[model samples]
Target: MTRASSQSDPFRLRAWIKVLAVGQLSYASAVAAADLAVPHPIAEGSNYTDWSGGYIGLQGSASGAYGDYAFSRTTVGGRAVPSFMSGDGTGRRDQGTTATTIVGGAFGGYNWQTGPWVYGVEADLSASNLKRPLPSTITGFGYEDADAFNIIRAKTDVFGSLRARLGYSFERYLVYGAFGLSGTNARFIGNYPDIDTGALNVAKHEVSFIGFNIGAGVQYAITESLALGLDYRYLDFGNSRRFSLGSVPGDAGGPVGTQANFNAHQLFLRLMWFPGGLRVPPDPAEIAPHDPDDGNSDRYSLHGQTTLIAQGTPGFRSPYVGDNSLIPHQARQTTTATIFLGLKVTDTTELYYNPEFSQGFGLSGTHGVAGFVNGEAQKAGAPYPRLRSNRYYIKQTINLGGETEDVPDGPNQVATRRDVNRITLLAGKFALGDFFDGNIYAHDPRVDFFNWSLWGSSAWDFPANLPGFTQGVYAEYNQAKFAVRAAATQVPKEQNSDVLDPRVFERAGLNAEFEGRYVLPWLDQSGKLRLGVFSNVGNVANNREIVTLTQLGIFDDINTAAVVTSKPRRKTGGYVNLEQALTPDLGLFARASLNDGRTTSLSFTDIDQSFSGGLSLKGTAWDRPGDTVGLGAAMNGLSPSHRAAFAAGYYGLLVGDGQLRYGTERAVETYYAINLTKFVTLTFDYQFVNNPNYNRDRGPAHFFASRLHADF
Candidate 1:
């Protein structure tokens, strides 16, 4: 009985295993067969077909956003200080808890589609202006009843993206993924009035960043000739850091720091038409043999497209401006346009040129140039008159006192006053290959022509020791889940001299970055974890003038100044970043970085180190048509120089201390976009910043902006 039972059990187990294997095989076969079937409606003819072509379209949108700014004061020394400070002060401060702004712009792109799959590249650009306000009252150090009020302004005259997309179609709906490079030109403007002294001041700054973008979207085909799509993009523009100070008295001459990152969700509805219904050339099997009339060439076809877009510029910091200030806290806008283009080429290859021109106006404008330039000079206590000489050829001796005493007396004249005009032209070609693709070219990336507004400002007028030609090349490779980039630049030692001075100082540097992503198979379909690393290395030529300044007690009386003057210094450093995707529309990211000071070379004795890190979150809700939203926040620690500036601004505000320390700076920002209808969209955004170094009278500050966009 035991033998019989054991034999039966073995047979039963084998039978069950066979049954399960057969079932699995059947399921695999079913799936394979289903995949082979046509994914989209097809015209009766050949077994396969391709409608691989390029297209162009136009889009418009509207948006709005709000910003919050905060500041605080801290004491560094026991010395008595002034009560009112200029620019950003040392003490804690807050501006319009929330300020609203408006903006708008236009965009266009090209695409190619095939059976169940599509691949193509696209480019888009836009312009916008936004504003906000700020107000504050300060009292301390023999000074009281000091009040400062002003508006903060911002103008994003430019935003652009270059991306490549790959997608799979499920009948009328298409799911796609994209990766690319993006850039933007943005500016900040601030205006403030000192109540105690009844003095008005203004400041402005411009900055740019280059980074990578990753995104996903879905497209729905409404008809044979019309389609609509919604996409979410996370743009990591790296760090766009700028240094500036407000025009307040004690706050003057401190570092004004700014950093920016952008992420957005966009939904677009488009209409498309093709002259001939995806015509397929005659298949040999379907055509009469050698028939003279059986030509495969297709007649000319015409297509048109129009799209409505909704987008947001969420995280912005304008501590110097208030909610209602003339300056916009955050700006959002919508734009609309129609595109018309023709396509013609052979099957083996095609050559085409698409020339596009568009115009749209939204809430956008930087601080006026005059106000920003003068404000910077005023903060330094140099002012315009102190920088210019009334008598061009006459030498005059004048006694310097008060704030002017801080200004270096030697070589005070502008040695190189120049108005620069720069233009860039880029052209490249792609060769289609069976396996690998390659590209090569030699072109002038950027060219600048300058007019010497004043002889003193001319680079040629400066001593051979102070050459001034800054130029370089930058490039990177971007993939679906990873990216890498490197760049090198050179700062000439002399403007026109053929001889390169080894002692005068020259600069050469390189920067690199790497990022990767890993999808979590056990989690939801969209979950992923990412990691990245970035580094930079460079050398800076030494300058005699710098050594002299150090000897004159300008830079802490460091003896290493002579060594720095004799030879260029070398600098090397890097950063690390990690991120995780919680869902299809949500994610968290963190990063840390360190650098060896601003100059190219590192002197072990004067070595400077900086570290910074932060977290960010982004996601979208698909409840409404043509509407999408996103949010992010970050905090960073500055170096001693940055801390000093922060401390200076803090103390200068509460105690009227002139000393500046660069301290820690932190910021938080968010944004949202909603579509009211096919022709209109609304956008809102806000940003909050905390800085111990800002020199504005309002202390730590806040900023906000918003906008309404329309499409036609």
Candidate 2:
């Protein structure tokens, strides 16, 4: 019998999803009513608009699945099956388990309308985290004098549907019903201990199935090109056949087989766009004149972007190797696509969601250097494409009655006018970098610098999960010349782990920053200075303790020692970020950050201190105003205790050679971005690292990269 880790709880995940749902709906009601207040004026005296075109949309959904896991029979070579598996002739069985989760995805279809009737075909694909644990029946079996038990788990990660729809139009609203074929990729995993040796035996079976689906919904045309809708869908996957739970040839029990039926119900809020949509030109007199400084004033906005990066390194020196060392010559690539969806509930309120697809890995699985290359590469990299909801948050602004300024339309932001002095509150899941760090010259990896240290404060150790996001609340008070921002968030449960710690009061992250803007005294150019501080309390181990444990022979190595010695400890740090505009086409940015380095690093790289500076220049000199060139360098260092741990073969979150020749890791990076069009850009990047992984004997490595990016 194997035990599940106590730190992980499914209820916590469900609880957060529930919080997100309640928060969204509570505010969405206001939006629904507000949407009806201003109706589009009828054009050409027509009561209906054309609904004939191809459309695509993004959706956020809540889904539940009921699964019957009753096992009908069991066979294991010549060995007698366990009582639980064989049902013991007593007919004792587990009825079922229900799984619920929040999901996000993309959909597209074509619609045709004639008079009051409309018809269409649609298809959608979504990623899921629907999972539930199953209760195991007593088998009346013994393993080495200990009672034996089993653990059963059921989960679904991906699902989709193809359907045909029919609807009736009522002016701007359309009510529809749909029937479709649906399928899900599911899994049933089992854990059993060896009856004699008490060793663990694992088995997993793919439990995917096809099903029939039915749904209905209503949509309202908010604009000629945009629509908002709500839908409910039901899917029934009939009983499945008995299948093996996987086993090797020489196992005591041959294999386990089980049968089950699955069914699901899903509710969705969809925002769609119609391509080549028919438009009723508004009366010229009713239209407002465009103002360049006023920016875009749309009720809602949609934007998307995709980035692909391929990087390689040339041969470098390496006298020895450790568990996490970069190879001399290597190549790797990563690709990502994201859709930014936003809705303005009111003049002061907005909701946003970003669904993303990612694949590929960083070189050497994102290790070998403290100041690593490839900012786009996630620590939890995947070889195959995976879809995930990266960000979904609500932003509310309270005006203090001052001069108004225009806010530009961009990803996660809708164009509007805001008070010069206002208080903004954000709640939900998002990356800390989105709001805290403001460096126009070196921030964004897709368009500017590509090295991790250059693009962000590497020593901050901000709270985040595997993909670098966290659920939390953030607030900012902005004035004409200064801004103050703060956030409290959940930290990862373990070092570089995707699971977040549920003990918010005891294990959380807090961050704050003060930004001041001013003009240079002599140059008369604008410059900004930002001071940031962060403190994290979590289950992290101190480097000194791990080193001590190793010295006493209580632990054989640093990796194992750190895990065993972990306790609730505090890690605090601060940073200075500065950016200056040298000219209209040239800018300079720099950052210096440091952490206590007493405990092991948690969410980010292992650098205890780092300094990076960069220069960004537009290609106006060459008459290519849309092009850019960047150059940056970073120096990363570790605290004395951290250095001692590394010298003693103590592994860090990243970077650790079996032995250490300590050195301040230094790297220089440069990139050139060529804007092929307003929506597309191609960039070439290169970086050189000295003393990779802080090991002086290891390398003076060189890296080259090519990136392609598109957005609209």
Candidate 3:
């Protein structure tokens, strides 16, 4: 988690201002005393000398921007219409203007100074929720009343940026220019009509964008160790367009049109602190030497931390089956406690272990263990694959899956499975450079966990399974303000019992995913906006084994035969997104994605093509003692068919569809957090999802949760 000053609430602003004021007054008083105590004149340094040489410093700044966005008619159906055409207009239009955003980021830099000139590169990244309102206007024939006028209002969410800087120092002041790529995720909200009928449509949109940033700033040193500065940046997100067609006829045309050009700008005031002097000698002997065993000696340190987490789900029991007996609703509560421990052995290596124990009123208690090792394989620069760090981990558990079964005239079925736990080995190299970095690694090669649930409960337990191995390799690269990542996963049939069951073995196959982003520079740091693209493809053997646990529960036996042979079903799709920083604490984002009918497997599938966008606001509202907070909200939409698929998956009704349909739900969530003290915080979160296709009678379900966190 990243911690920064808040930008949203007015109370927070006043509190921070007071703190700064007090600090300034204290500094002034100290300076006065120092002036009276010192009498010697300070020596002047050379005018041609530059104040640079791999210096490190901390900076704090205030940032803000404006984000403008409009929804296209084609993306969603056009504006809403009356049951009977009243003559307001044949075609409806759903259009909105852009909103404002605000956010701030901290940065540090290093420079090598030469006479009158300093050159090097500096990089910084920030996470912010900058949002803007997605204003939607409806213009139609019979939609005259404001209440009858169908309109959708929403905001955008989370966004970020990365940039590099170059500069020249003159005496006590330095002027610099920077250029780097950036990206963001935006949200769009609106209401349209059904393609067939002229009814109103309500939904939210989440989008992504890639763009670039450019800025200039000048810093003046108050002393050799402190500096104050100001900077300005411009950002341009080229043609971030979104298209959609609504469910209704009137809403289908112009209302579903497009968002054309997007852009923004930002300005900030910054202060920096450098603890040590500007320069350090290449050899330790060049300067006064300190005792090796002194308190300030540089040496490796070891530390550790542990956390306890508790979670529960009410109203529904998980459908998975495990080793434990059936868990009763309301009658039996499932509770678990876990311990996570870590050891920092060196600057580049650490080891960790996490163990968990769970107990239920009517079921057997169980225990689980997981361990991991993380370390740098070699020094900064080493040969290719040999230069990679390796990580090995293993997890073992004995538990039930899903919910318990209540059979009418048969013996109750309890989870009964035990096999060697899953083992995972990962190795990857970290890149080093001012402009680029890359990592490549291979993931676990075995089916690590079995997912199952019994009838009548909402608890999901993991069952130990030693199925055939499933492994994948992934690589990612970041260069010139752009990032790209690709991954491929493969599962062979001979590794498990399913492979021997010809019907299931054939279903094993390969899957891959690729994504990239490019930042636009027209917009400055404050006005961040970017463009992004992503693609995914998968090939599955049709003859793979198929098992319908739900059907077996209903009929007490396998009732269906395998239909497709594992010949590798091919699925592929792609998407484009645009994100903009609207204010110092808010952001606007939009995106359109389309997936072909091929990659619809367990983890790689989409119900249908989707276009979404929304706004989000994230910033600290208060910085005073015991008064810190952050807040955020978002909304989105899904086609009816897609919504149905999602509903089915949520209810555990579709066994073989995999995890694809779960991505189709239309939903929204709001979150807020408050700091009670420096180490303690409270958070509240709520989620609302509408899945009309599942459970038939329950239109949508609302979930609420709260958490208290303490950091030591």
Number of the top-ranking candidate, with TM-score as the measure: 2
Candidates sorted by TM-score, descending order?
2, 1, 3
Which 10 consecutive residues of model 1 have the lowest summed lDDT? 442-451
Better of 1 and 3 by TM-score: 1
Model 1, which residues run further than 4 Å from truth?
Answer: 1-485, 489-506, 525-569, 598-622, 641-662, 675-682, 692-698, 707-712
Off by over 4 Å in 2: 1-297
Candidate with more favorable, higher TM-score: 2 or 3: 2
Tens-digit lDDT track for model 1 on 395-464? 1122222221111111112111111221111112110010011000100000000001100111011111
In the range 272-390, model 3's lDDT, one tens digit per residue, is 55544332112223334533233323222211111111111123222332111111111111212223343323322334343432221110111000000001100111110111111
Show model 3 residue runs off by greater than 4 Å: 1-472, 490-523, 526-568, 575-580, 588-594, 597-600, 604-616, 622-664, 676-680, 692-696, 710-712
lDDT of predicted model 2 = 0.75
List TM-scores for all candidates, in order. Answer: 0.32, 0.63, 0.32
lDDT of 1 at 76: 15
Estimate, for each residue in 500-541, the C-alpha lDDT of model 2 and write its tens digit.
899998899999999999999787799999999999988889
Q: For model 3, give the 10-residue run with minimal summed lDDT.
A: 368-377
Top candidate when judged by lDDT against the true structure = 2
The Cα local distance difference test for each model comes to: 0.33, 0.75, 0.32
